[model samples]
Target: MTIKVLVADDHAAVRAGIVLILDGAADLEVVGEAADGEQAVAMARELRPDVVVMDIRMPRLDGISATRELAGVTDVLILTTFDIDEYVFGALRAGAAGFLLKNTDADGLVGAVRLVARGDGMISPGVTRKLISAFAAQPAREPSTRDLSVLTAREQEVLACIARGLSNAEIAGELDMAEATTKTHVSRVLGKLGLKSRVQAAIFYSESG
Candidate 1:
């Protein structure tokens, strides 16, 4: 399947450049572009791209807020110039599937888009320390651990994998289960927990752990 992507950045040149690189790939297409955070959200809802290449800084709104607003609607891969941008953690909390440096090479950029499109997550190694420190400094919230006992063992396992950022196929592989069975388990877990997406599941585990 061709992976549709939405490129959002304030700089016209940057957005055009991303499109040039992505459009060259046989398996990828730039379905849309947005010049700011608000436009990003609107275009995302309108086009429903598989992935969004988002910037950290933009006028009218910021990437973190846009990421929060669009979480679960589409995968967000943050493209930022700063290695240690403060907004990276917020984007993660908002369910961004990947984080990348603006200076990342063309191949890395394409790989990130494709990975996230396939329901995987990634971050550049250079910025891993900053992300770790940011996650560590924040006081973890106390999630409602009591009510989760109602879930069956299989459901619990699915939830754990979701929290770890695994796609349905990945979970199936890890559990020696079929892909269809994995979907049923994930749906069951979501229904039981009253959660909308894996991002929430991940946050719950992060706090509970």
Candidate 2:
């Protein structure tokens, strides 16, 4: 199935570049473009694209806030030049399905959109380790009120692998299970934890520690 996408960036040139690359992919289509956060939200609600490629520092709402507003509406992929802790944490907390640096290559950009559209999460490889370490170093937040006990033992193992940033195939290999089984465990874990995506599950595990 073709994945519809909305590109949002304040810079016209940058927005055009993103649209060009996404439109190049056979399975991806650029349905619309937005120049700012408000426009992004408006377009997203109207177009209901599979993914929205967003920039952080727009004039009106900012990507994080727009992401917050878009939480259950559509998945968001934050593609921005900033890799600072604030933006990274902010976007994820705001419910972005993926976070990527603007320096990412065309293929990486295409891959990230596809991954988010598949209900998975992607963080730029360059920033993933640092983001996890920083999150671990911060004083632990209050324990999650969500009950992890609801998950089966296998599902718990899957959650741990997610916190370690393992892909579905890696989790399957690690646990000596099939990849399809791993995906089922992952879906159950998220559903039981009341989480939106793998990224949120990872954060929950971190906060629970």
Candidate 3:
């Protein structure tokens, strides 16, 4: 099936470039383009694209707030120039499925959009480690540490692998299980933790550790 996408960036060139890249992909379609966050949200609601490629510093609503509003209704992939963007944590917490740098290669960008469109989370490897470490440094509550007790031993192991930025295939290889089984464990972990995506699972594991 063709994955419909909405590209939102303040720069016309950036939007054009991304649309061009996506248009080249046989399975991806650019359904709409927005110059700012508000228009992105409005177009998203109207177009209901499978994914939204968003920039954080857009005018009016901002991508973080827009992601919060669109959370659960559609997936969001944050494509921006900032690797350690100040708004990165907020966007993830607001329900973005992935965070990517604008400098990412064409294949990487296309792959990330496809991954997020299917409800998987993707974060730049360096940014993932940095984000986890930064969030882990914050003061966490006592009860938050105990939340891991709810997970089974294998589930805890899966969570740790996710916190380390291991994909399902990697986690499966590490645990000597099939990739599909690893995915099941991941889904269970998220459901048990009341989390939305692997990004949240990673954050929770980091803070709880």
* TM-score list, all predictions: 0.82, 0.83, 0.78
Candidate 3, 10-71: lDDT as tens digits = 99998999999998999999999999999999999999999999999899988888888887
List model 1 lDDT by residue over 78-132, tens digit each.
9999765667667776778788988899999999898778666778887677766
lDDT of 2 by residue, 36-72 (tens): 9999999999999999999999998899999999987
- Clashes per candidate, residues 3 or more apart or on different chains: 0, 0, 0
Candidate with best TM-score: 2
Q: State the displacement of the C-alpha of residue 181, model 2, in Å, after optimal TM-score superposition.
A: 8.1
lDDT of each: 0.84, 0.90, 0.87
* Candidate 1, lDDT over the whole model: 0.84
Superposing all C-alpha atoms, what RMSD in Å does each candidate have to the true structure?
A: 2.9, 2.9, 3.2
**Pairs in steric clash, model 1:** none
Q: TM-score of the candidate numbered 1?
A: 0.82
Q: Pick the candidate with the highest lDDT.
A: 2
Runs off by more than 4 Å, candidate 3 = 135-161, 164-192
User: TM-score of model 2 relative to the true fold?
Assistant: 0.83
